[model samples]
Target: MTGLSPDARAWLEQHGFIPTDDAVWLEALTHGSFNGSGPADAADYQRLEFLGDRVLGLSVAAWLFRAGDAPEGKLSQRLNALVSGTTCARIARSIGLPEHIRLGKQARDDGGADSDKILGDVMEALIGACFIEHGFDTAQGLIYRLWAKELEGDVGKAKHPKSALQEWAAGNRRAPPVYTVTDRSGPDHAARFTVEVSVRNVGNAEATASSKGEAERLAAKAFLERFG
Candidate 1:
């Protein structure tokens, strides 16, 4: 109701995602924090998230199985990387999923609508909703369309900065880089972190990010790029 339009529906359908139940679609877009009064009042996306996570895992696993020539370990690693929170968030953003998310006033006011975590969860929920409305084939088709770029091109290639850093460190025989939070600032609700990454023998590099985890990842990536 809030974000759905004929154009949006047509776009999604053309991309292989068909939602038979509009209410389910809306629920998939709703955030849990917005459902203060419970499911009867406002159905949230948590259940759909759970279902979608499993569906995505299964779909990716099936894809790897059919792709061929990949070892179990390699396939597992690729699956993990592809399904990571960052990757999912990126996919959500690419589809403009955040624009369709249904957040409560508080969440909208606090910028929760644009949050990667929320967007990622909602993306999963959308997948789950599609799966329920149609089936695995439909859901997988949609996922493939969304992820074709990442999956079709060098499926096992390590592209992320963090992964690149680890590979470089291991190759150079230096103790793996170490990341530490050097500083934290901002309000309690929206804190930012500065991270410093020190390679065993190389100099330290620093980066700032909205979250400590992200900052550490960025710092490690920067250190690897500069010194690895």
Candidate 2:
């Protein structure tokens, strides 16, 4: 499309995405709110996101199985961390995908392009588009390339921060950390939550995210960083 930058086009090409039908790829970058009410039609990213989620799961699982000799539990943990929305958004940002996303006037003005939820979904949809245009092997190669850093990171560190924090609390003889939703704001479609995690006498930290669960996880991570 005309709006896509030369670099973006090149990046897509590098990822093996050369769309014969531009409409599908364009739809992959389009938000449901692009029409300002809901999806203007069926040509939005949700269905693509659904497909991409599975594709990502399979690709990551297969890669991990071959890449490591870890047992199933460790592999599952690593896979969950790798496929999380936070990780997806990180990958999307690394590739400048946010700039390619199409949003409605209101959504754009509301910072939809910067929303982790939108970026993560768009990343998945983009992968789906790659799969559709190319095929599984090509899409898997793209996933591996995009996700290389995460896949190669210390697997033990891939343990969930909340789990680590809870273990820290138990070992330190402190009350289990408590998380409270301190704030919820923004449009319903793009709501943000601020959560606080506190362990008595040790420390407390707060973080904001697109979902309550993510907010809680981030808050726990922050608390551990600050105090543990």
Candidate 3:
């Protein structure tokens, strides 16, 4: 089997993490779709991803709380943005994680390696592995390092546009924003989805992206830009 590439090893070393158990790291990079059998191997990243979600939530919340007096609501918003799958996928790409993911032949051919969902899941799994191997403090440090830029940005606007639009609707006494998938095309691996969001009596916006969530976010941002 192919092992971690030399560059991948160097990247981890640069981040101050050296795996004590290589098997765990490998499992963290494995996807469920990798095995077409009845059930995925117990070592797949799903469980690790689950743990990592909670770990990430706690880590971000604690940091936001300690960093300043940003009140609960603002802190929560920043936390959501920081731990979002989009942000996770961005971090994964920044660190060259797509090259390390293990996938089935079909999945690889289908662009699974660059999929936001897969990258986000694998990123969380890697964090879980880090937590298990190096303890929470180390995992927290890694998270902080990876998220420093985002954390330093405008925390007020860190909320997803979709959520921001929803709040605007509520404050303005309007119906909630409704989103519908207006178009979809492309192959399974690189499919694109177009979503349109309409806010009652406000306006409509449309966007397309490789994933539905991203499309929705873009659509919301567009609507907000045009009418908000």
TM-score: which candidate is best?
2
Candidate 2 lDDT, tens digit per residue, 110-173?
8888888899899999889889988899889989988988888864456688999999999999
Ten contiguous residues minimizing lDDT sum, candidate 2? 34-43
Check candidate 1 and list the clashing pairs.
none
lDDT (CA) per prediction: 0.77, 0.85, 0.83
Candidate with more favorable, higher TM-score: 1 or 2: 2
lDDT of 1: 0.77
Clash totals in order: 0, 0, 0
lDDT of 2 at 188: 62
If scored against the real structure, what TM-score would every candidate get?
0.80, 0.86, 0.85
Model 1, position 81, has a per-residue lDDT of 69
What TM-score would candidate 2 get against the native?
A: 0.86
Report lDDT (Cα) of residue 97, candidate 1.
75
Model 3: per-residue Cα lDDT over 1-228, one tens digit each: 345557766777776667777767777888766666313543679888998888898998998888889878888778877888878998899988897787877788888888887898899998998998989999989888888887777744567798899998999999999999999986665578999999877789999988898899899999989988
Q: Is candidate 1 or candidate 2 better by lDDT?
A: 2
